[model samples]
Target: MNRDKDIYVLLTDTGTVLTKIIRTFTKDPLNHASIAFDEDLNEVYSFGRKNPSNPFFAGFVRENVRGEFFEESMCALYRCKVSQSAYSGIRAQIQHFEQYSDLYKYNLAGMLGVVLNIEWEREYAYFCSQFVATIFKRSGVSLVDKSPLLVTPGDFQTTPHLELIYHGKLHDYTGCEVTAAAAGGSFRTA
Candidate 1:
Protein backbone atom coordinates (compact mmCIF):
# COMPACT_ATOMS: atom_id res chain seq x y z
CA MET A 1 0.00 0.00 0.00
CA ASN A 2 2.19 2.90 -1.10
CA ARG A 3 1.59 4.98 2.06
CA ASP A 4 3.80 7.85 0.99
CA LYS A 5 1.88 8.07 -2.28
CA ASP A 6 -1.53 9.58 -2.92
CA ILE A 7 -4.94 7.97 -3.09
CA TYR A 8 -7.54 9.03 -5.64
CA VAL A 9 -11.27 9.52 -5.32
CA LEU A 10 -13.07 9.55 -8.64
CA LEU A 11 -16.51 11.11 -9.03
CA THR A 12 -18.34 9.98 -12.11
CA ASP A 13 -21.47 10.10 -14.23
CA THR A 14 -21.82 7.27 -16.69
CA GLY A 15 -24.87 8.87 -18.39
CA THR A 16 -26.99 5.85 -17.69
CA VAL A 17 -30.69 6.32 -17.05
CA LEU A 18 -30.06 5.59 -13.40
CA THR A 19 -27.44 8.29 -13.24
CA LYS A 20 -29.77 10.68 -15.00
CA ILE A 21 -32.35 10.04 -12.30
CA ILE A 22 -29.75 10.61 -9.62
CA ARG A 23 -28.57 13.84 -11.17
CA THR A 24 -32.13 15.03 -11.37
CA PHE A 25 -32.65 14.39 -7.68
CA THR A 26 -29.29 15.56 -6.38
CA LYS A 27 -28.88 18.34 -8.94
CA ASP A 28 -25.30 17.17 -9.28
CA PRO A 29 -23.34 15.85 -12.22
CA LEU A 30 -21.66 13.23 -10.11
CA ASN A 31 -23.67 10.15 -9.26
CA HIS A 32 -20.99 7.57 -8.48
CA ALA A 33 -17.70 7.39 -6.60
CA SER A 34 -14.66 5.10 -6.55
CA ILE A 35 -11.15 4.93 -5.12
CA ALA A 36 -7.81 4.24 -6.73
CA PHE A 37 -4.46 3.53 -5.17
CA ASP A 38 -2.47 5.79 -7.45
CA GLU A 39 -2.63 8.82 -9.69
CA ASP A 40 -2.77 6.76 -12.86
CA LEU A 41 -6.24 5.42 -11.95
CA ASN A 42 -6.05 2.21 -14.00
CA GLU A 43 -8.46 0.43 -11.67
CA VAL A 44 -10.84 1.74 -9.03
CA TYR A 45 -12.84 0.15 -6.25
CA SER A 46 -16.48 0.90 -5.47
CA PHE A 47 -19.74 -0.70 -4.51
CA GLY A 48 -21.55 -0.39 -7.78
CA ARG A 49 -22.95 -2.10 -10.82
CA LYS A 50 -21.21 -5.41 -11.23
CA ASN A 51 -22.02 -5.65 -14.91
CA PRO A 52 -21.12 -2.69 -17.11
CA SER A 53 -24.45 -2.69 -18.91
CA ASN A 54 -26.65 -4.10 -16.20
CA PRO A 55 -27.70 -1.76 -13.45
CA PHE A 56 -29.03 -4.47 -11.14
CA PHE A 57 -27.02 -7.25 -9.56
CA ALA A 58 -24.52 -4.77 -8.18
CA GLY A 59 -22.06 -5.21 -5.34
CA PHE A 60 -18.48 -4.37 -4.51
CA VAL A 61 -16.76 -3.85 -7.85
CA ARG A 62 -13.32 -3.09 -9.17
CA GLU A 63 -14.13 -0.82 -12.09
CA ASN A 64 -12.19 0.39 -15.11
CA VAL A 65 -12.65 3.79 -16.73
CA ARG A 66 -11.49 2.55 -20.11
CA GLY A 67 -13.93 -0.30 -20.07
CA GLU A 68 -17.16 -0.32 -22.05
CA PHE A 69 -19.21 0.79 -19.06
CA PHE A 70 -17.23 3.89 -18.23
CA GLU A 71 -15.87 4.66 -21.70
CA GLU A 72 -18.54 7.33 -22.08
CA SER A 73 -18.45 8.54 -18.50
CA MET A 74 -17.68 12.06 -17.38
CA CYS A 75 -15.31 12.01 -14.45
CA ALA A 76 -13.80 14.35 -11.87
CA LEU A 77 -10.66 13.29 -10.08
CA TYR A 78 -9.59 14.16 -6.53
CA ARG A 79 -6.60 13.10 -4.48
CA CYS A 80 -5.46 12.88 -0.88
CA LYS A 81 -2.00 12.12 0.43
CA VAL A 82 -2.30 9.97 3.53
CA SER A 83 0.06 8.55 6.13
CA GLN A 84 1.71 5.24 5.28
CA SER A 85 -0.18 3.57 8.07
CA ALA A 86 -3.45 4.98 6.79
CA TYR A 87 -2.64 3.78 3.32
CA SER A 88 -1.97 0.29 4.60
CA GLY A 89 -5.20 0.33 6.59
CA ILE A 90 -7.19 1.55 3.61
CA ARG A 91 -5.71 -1.05 1.29
CA ALA A 92 -6.32 -3.76 3.83
CA GLN A 93 -9.98 -2.79 4.23
CA ILE A 94 -10.50 -2.73 0.49
CA GLN A 95 -8.72 -6.03 0.05
CA HIS A 96 -10.81 -7.53 2.80
CA PHE A 97 -14.05 -6.54 1.10
CA GLU A 98 -12.66 -7.71 -2.23
CA GLN A 99 -11.63 -11.04 -0.82
CA TYR A 100 -15.16 -12.00 0.14
CA SER A 101 -17.06 -9.71 -2.16
CA ASP A 102 -19.76 -12.31 -2.52
CA LEU A 103 -20.56 -12.03 1.15
CA TYR A 104 -21.10 -8.35 0.69
CA LYS A 105 -23.92 -6.66 -1.17
CA TYR A 106 -24.84 -3.23 -2.46
CA ASN A 107 -26.71 -1.00 -0.01
CA LEU A 108 -29.64 -0.29 -2.27
CA ALA A 109 -31.69 0.95 0.69
CA GLY A 110 -29.03 3.47 1.56
CA MET A 111 -29.60 5.20 -1.75
CA LEU A 112 -33.00 6.29 -0.42
CA GLY A 113 -31.33 8.12 2.43
CA VAL A 114 -29.81 10.53 -0.04
CA VAL A 115 -33.24 11.61 -1.20
CA LEU A 116 -34.87 11.47 2.22
CA ASN A 117 -31.97 12.83 4.22
CA ILE A 118 -32.15 9.89 6.56
CA GLU A 119 -29.27 7.74 7.73
CA TRP A 120 -29.39 4.07 6.86
CA GLU A 121 -26.80 1.35 6.47
CA ARG A 122 -26.96 -2.40 6.28
CA GLU A 123 -24.38 -4.81 7.63
CA TYR A 124 -21.95 -6.16 5.06
CA ALA A 125 -23.40 -3.82 2.43
CA TYR A 126 -22.50 -0.44 1.08
CA PHE A 127 -23.17 2.06 -1.67
CA CYS A 128 -20.29 3.50 -3.68
CA SER A 129 -19.83 6.81 -1.87
CA GLN A 130 -20.28 5.37 1.58
CA PHE A 131 -17.99 2.50 0.79
CA VAL A 132 -15.27 4.96 -0.22
CA ALA A 133 -15.96 7.10 2.84
CA THR A 134 -15.80 4.08 5.10
CA ILE A 135 -12.41 3.09 3.74
CA PHE A 136 -11.00 6.53 4.34
CA LYS A 137 -12.38 6.66 7.86
CA ARG A 138 -11.15 3.20 8.72
CA SER A 139 -7.72 4.20 7.44
CA GLY A 140 -7.54 7.24 9.72
CA VAL A 141 -8.12 9.58 6.81
CA SER A 142 -11.74 10.48 7.25
CA LEU A 143 -13.07 12.47 4.34
CA VAL A 144 -15.95 14.17 6.14
CA ASP A 145 -17.59 14.12 9.55
CA LYS A 146 -20.89 13.00 8.09
CA SER A 147 -22.02 9.46 8.51
CA PRO A 148 -20.58 7.32 5.76
CA LEU A 149 -23.97 5.78 4.97
CA LEU A 150 -25.34 9.22 4.18
CA VAL A 151 -22.45 10.34 1.99
CA THR A 152 -22.89 10.97 -1.71
CA PRO A 153 -20.43 11.40 -4.52
CA GLY A 154 -20.92 15.15 -4.24
CA ASP A 155 -20.01 15.04 -0.55
CA PHE A 156 -16.44 14.20 -1.46
CA GLN A 157 -16.19 17.76 -2.71
CA THR A 158 -16.77 19.01 0.81
CA THR A 159 -13.79 17.11 2.15
CA PRO A 160 -10.99 19.46 3.15
CA HIS A 161 -8.17 17.25 1.93
CA LEU A 162 -9.52 16.22 -1.47
CA GLU A 163 -7.64 17.97 -4.26
CA LEU A 164 -9.18 18.36 -7.66
CA ILE A 165 -6.92 16.80 -10.29
CA TYR A 166 -8.99 16.39 -13.45
CA HIS A 167 -12.47 16.69 -14.87
CA GLY A 168 -13.63 15.50 -18.30
CA LYS A 169 -14.78 12.52 -20.28
CA LEU A 170 -13.08 9.37 -19.07
CA HIS A 171 -12.83 8.20 -22.66
CA ASP A 172 -11.10 11.44 -23.62
CA TYR A 173 -8.67 11.46 -20.71
CA THR A 174 -5.03 11.60 -21.77
CA GLY A 175 -3.28 12.87 -18.69
CA CYS A 176 -3.70 16.53 -19.69
CA GLU A 177 -2.88 17.81 -16.22
CA VAL A 178 -2.47 14.88 -13.90
CA THR A 179 -0.28 12.16 -15.32
CA ALA A 180 -2.63 9.28 -15.92
CA ALA A 181 -0.39 6.53 -14.68
CA ALA A 182 1.39 4.76 -17.52
CA ALA A 183 0.26 1.70 -15.60
CA GLY A 184 -1.79 1.30 -12.44
CA GLY A 185 -3.49 -1.22 -10.20
CA SER A 186 -5.83 -3.34 -12.32
CA PHE A 187 -9.39 -4.42 -11.49
CA ARG A 188 -9.35 -6.99 -8.73
CA THR A 189 -10.07 -10.61 -9.58
CA ALA A 190 -12.89 -12.31 -7.67
Candidate 2:
Protein backbone atom coordinates (compact mmCIF):
# COMPACT_ATOMS: atom_id res chain seq x y z
CA MET A 1 0.00 0.00 0.00
CA ASN A 2 1.22 3.46 -0.86
CA ARG A 3 1.15 6.14 1.77
CA ASP A 4 0.00 8.63 -0.82
CA LYS A 5 -3.10 6.59 -1.61
CA ASP A 6 -6.21 7.00 0.53
CA ILE A 7 -7.56 4.40 2.93
CA TYR A 8 -11.16 4.64 4.16
CA VAL A 9 -12.97 4.45 7.45
CA LEU A 10 -16.63 3.61 7.02
CA LEU A 11 -19.36 4.41 9.52
CA THR A 12 -22.85 3.14 8.96
CA ASP A 13 -26.33 3.27 10.49
CA THR A 14 -27.86 0.14 9.08
CA GLY A 15 -31.43 1.10 10.16
CA THR A 16 -32.20 -2.08 12.00
CA VAL A 17 -34.12 -2.37 15.27
CA LEU A 18 -30.91 -3.25 17.05
CA THR A 19 -29.11 -0.26 15.56
CA LYS A 20 -32.04 1.90 16.61
CA ILE A 21 -31.62 0.78 20.21
CA ILE A 22 -27.89 1.48 20.06
CA ARG A 23 -28.69 4.92 18.63
CA THR A 24 -30.82 5.86 21.66
CA PHE A 25 -27.84 5.31 23.92
CA THR A 26 -24.98 6.64 21.79
CA LYS A 27 -27.24 9.42 20.46
CA ASP A 28 -25.23 9.39 17.26
CA PRO A 29 -25.85 8.53 13.65
CA LEU A 30 -23.24 5.78 13.65
CA ASN A 31 -23.37 2.37 15.25
CA HIS A 32 -20.76 0.55 13.18
CA ALA A 33 -17.20 1.12 11.93
CA SER A 34 -15.33 -0.63 9.14
CA ILE A 35 -11.98 -0.21 7.38
CA ALA A 36 -11.17 -0.49 3.73
CA PHE A 37 -7.90 -1.08 1.90
CA ASP A 38 -8.85 0.97 -1.16
CA GLU A 39 -10.53 4.32 -1.56
CA ASP A 40 -13.13 2.64 -3.77
CA LEU A 41 -13.99 0.43 -0.80
CA ASN A 42 -15.12 -2.54 -2.87
CA GLU A 43 -14.79 -4.71 0.21
CA VAL A 44 -14.95 -3.33 3.77
CA TYR A 45 -13.97 -5.21 6.90
CA SER A 46 -15.60 -4.96 10.32
CA PHE A 47 -17.16 -6.84 13.22
CA GLY A 48 -20.83 -6.70 12.42
CA ARG A 49 -23.85 -8.89 11.79
CA LYS A 50 -22.65 -11.84 9.72
CA ASN A 51 -26.27 -12.34 8.89
CA PRO A 52 -27.90 -8.99 8.21
CA SER A 53 -31.30 -10.36 9.19
CA ASN A 54 -29.99 -11.40 12.58
CA PRO A 55 -27.98 -8.93 14.65
CA PHE A 56 -26.68 -11.58 17.00
CA PHE A 57 -24.77 -13.72 14.54
CA ALA A 58 -21.71 -11.56 14.01
CA GLY A 59 -17.97 -11.49 13.83
CA PHE A 60 -15.66 -10.23 11.09
CA VAL A 61 -17.76 -9.06 8.17
CA ARG A 62 -16.73 -8.05 4.68
CA GLU A 63 -19.25 -5.46 3.50
CA ASN A 64 -20.28 -4.13 0.13
CA VAL A 65 -21.44 -0.52 -0.08
CA ARG A 66 -23.24 -0.81 -3.40
CA GLY A 67 -24.76 -4.19 -2.76
CA GLU A 68 -28.46 -4.87 -2.29
CA PHE A 69 -27.72 -5.88 1.29
CA PHE A 70 -26.94 -2.25 2.20
CA GLU A 71 -29.64 -0.54 0.18
CA GLU A 72 -31.28 1.05 3.20
CA SER A 73 -28.22 2.12 5.14
CA MET A 74 -26.72 5.57 5.63
CA CYS A 75 -22.99 6.04 5.78
CA ALA A 76 -20.22 8.51 6.51
CA LEU A 77 -17.00 7.95 4.66
CA TYR A 78 -13.66 9.23 5.91
CA ARG A 79 -10.21 9.20 4.41
CA CYS A 80 -6.80 9.17 6.04
CA LYS A 81 -3.29 9.09 4.66
CA VAL A 82 -1.09 6.66 6.54
CA SER A 83 2.46 5.42 6.01
CA GLN A 84 2.81 2.31 3.87
CA SER A 85 4.12 0.43 6.87
CA ALA A 86 1.12 1.46 8.94
CA TYR A 87 -1.28 0.49 6.17
CA SER A 88 0.46 -2.83 5.74
CA GLY A 89 0.23 -3.60 9.42
CA ILE A 90 -3.44 -2.69 9.48
CA ARG A 91 -4.23 -4.82 6.45
CA ALA A 92 -2.23 -7.72 7.76
CA GLN A 93 -4.07 -7.67 11.06
CA ILE A 94 -7.42 -7.53 9.31
CA GLN A 95 -6.37 -10.37 7.01
CA HIS A 96 -5.27 -12.45 9.96
CA PHE A 97 -8.73 -12.24 11.50
CA GLU A 98 -10.35 -12.73 8.12
CA GLN A 99 -8.40 -15.89 7.42
CA TYR A 100 -9.57 -17.42 10.68
CA SER A 101 -12.94 -15.77 10.87
CA ASP A 102 -14.60 -18.93 12.14
CA LEU A 103 -12.69 -18.60 15.38
CA TYR A 104 -13.98 -15.08 16.02
CA LYS A 105 -17.29 -14.22 17.63
CA TYR A 106 -19.34 -11.13 18.32
CA ASN A 107 -18.41 -9.46 21.57
CA LEU A 108 -21.72 -9.09 23.31
CA ALA A 109 -19.87 -8.87 26.60
CA GLY A 110 -17.82 -5.96 25.30
CA MET A 111 -21.01 -4.19 24.32
CA LEU A 112 -22.25 -4.70 27.86
CA GLY A 113 -19.08 -2.96 29.02
CA VAL A 114 -20.07 0.05 26.95
CA VAL A 115 -23.44 0.31 28.67
CA LEU A 116 -21.84 -0.01 32.09
CA ASN A 117 -18.95 2.35 31.26
CA ILE A 118 -16.47 -0.46 31.80
CA GLU A 119 -13.95 -1.98 29.41
CA TRP A 120 -13.48 -5.66 28.70
CA GLU A 121 -12.31 -8.01 25.97
CA ARG A 122 -12.88 -11.66 25.20
CA GLU A 123 -10.61 -13.94 23.25
CA TYR A 124 -10.97 -13.37 19.49
CA ALA A 125 -14.22 -11.54 19.95
CA TYR A 126 -14.96 -7.93 19.00
CA PHE A 127 -17.62 -5.38 18.28
CA CYS A 128 -17.54 -3.07 15.28
CA SER A 129 -15.71 -0.03 16.63
CA GLN A 130 -13.32 -1.95 18.85
CA PHE A 131 -12.25 -4.10 15.94
CA VAL A 132 -11.43 -1.05 13.83
CA ALA A 133 -9.86 0.76 16.77
CA THR A 134 -7.62 -2.20 17.54
CA ILE A 135 -6.49 -2.34 13.93
CA PHE A 136 -5.52 1.33 13.98
CA LYS A 137 -3.67 0.99 17.26
CA ARG A 138 -1.89 -2.17 16.15
CA SER A 139 -0.77 -0.38 13.02
CA GLY A 140 0.79 2.37 15.19
CA VAL A 141 -1.80 4.80 13.86
CA SER A 142 -3.72 6.04 16.82
CA LEU A 143 -7.05 7.39 15.64
CA VAL A 144 -8.39 8.19 19.10
CA ASP A 145 -6.86 8.96 22.46
CA LYS A 146 -9.16 6.53 24.25
CA SER A 147 -8.73 2.83 24.79
CA PRO A 148 -9.72 0.68 21.83
CA LEU A 149 -12.05 -1.35 24.03
CA LEU A 150 -13.90 1.82 24.98
CA VAL A 151 -13.97 3.48 21.58
CA THR A 152 -17.21 3.97 19.65
CA PRO A 153 -18.04 4.63 16.05
CA GLY A 154 -18.90 8.21 16.92
CA ASP A 155 -15.46 8.75 18.43
CA PHE A 156 -13.87 8.56 15.01
CA GLN A 157 -15.85 11.66 14.06
CA THR A 158 -13.59 13.65 16.39
CA THR A 159 -10.36 12.14 15.09
CA PRO A 160 -8.13 15.09 14.18
CA HIS A 161 -6.30 13.28 11.40
CA LEU A 162 -9.41 11.80 9.77
CA GLU A 163 -10.97 13.84 7.00
CA LEU A 164 -14.76 13.70 6.76
CA ILE A 165 -15.13 13.17 3.05
CA TYR A 166 -18.70 12.03 2.47
CA HIS A 167 -22.03 11.44 4.23
CA GLY A 168 -24.97 10.01 2.35
CA LYS A 169 -26.96 6.93 1.44
CA LEU A 170 -24.62 3.96 1.14
CA HIS A 171 -26.39 2.81 -1.99
CA ASP A 172 -25.66 6.08 -3.73
CA TYR A 173 -21.96 6.03 -2.87
CA THR A 174 -19.96 4.79 -5.83
CA GLY A 175 -16.79 4.71 -3.72
CA CYS A 176 -14.82 6.07 -6.67
CA GLU A 177 -14.54 9.67 -5.45
CA VAL A 178 -15.42 9.35 -1.80
CA THR A 179 -13.97 12.81 -1.45
CA ALA A 180 -15.52 14.52 -4.41
CA ALA A 181 -14.06 17.86 -3.45
CA ALA A 182 -10.47 16.65 -3.24
CA ALA A 183 -11.02 13.93 -5.87
CA GLY A 184 -8.11 11.45 -5.87
CA GLY A 185 -6.06 13.79 -3.67
CA SER A 186 -5.68 13.21 0.07
CA PHE A 187 -4.11 15.39 2.74
CA ARG A 188 -2.06 14.50 5.78
CA THR A 189 -2.59 15.99 9.22
CA ALA A 190 0.26 17.48 11.14
* Model 2 Cα lDDT, one tens digit per residue, 87-176: 888878878987999999989789779877899889999988999889989888899998888888999999987898777766556643
Candidate 2, run of 10 with poorest lDDT: 180-189
TM-score of each: 0.87, 0.88
The TM-score of predicted model 2 comes to 0.88
Please give, for residues 1-190, the per-residue lDDT of candidate 1 as tens digits: 4537688999999889888988888788889999998667786899888887678889999887777777667788888888888888988988898899999888888988868989887898898898999999988887987888888899887788888877766665634333334323122111
Clash tally, candidates in order: 1, 0
Superposed on all Cα atoms, model 2 deviates from the true structure by an RMSD in Å of 4.3
What residue pairs clash in candidate 2, if any at all?
Answer: none
- Name the regions of candidate 2 deviating beyond 4 angstroms: 1-5, 175-190
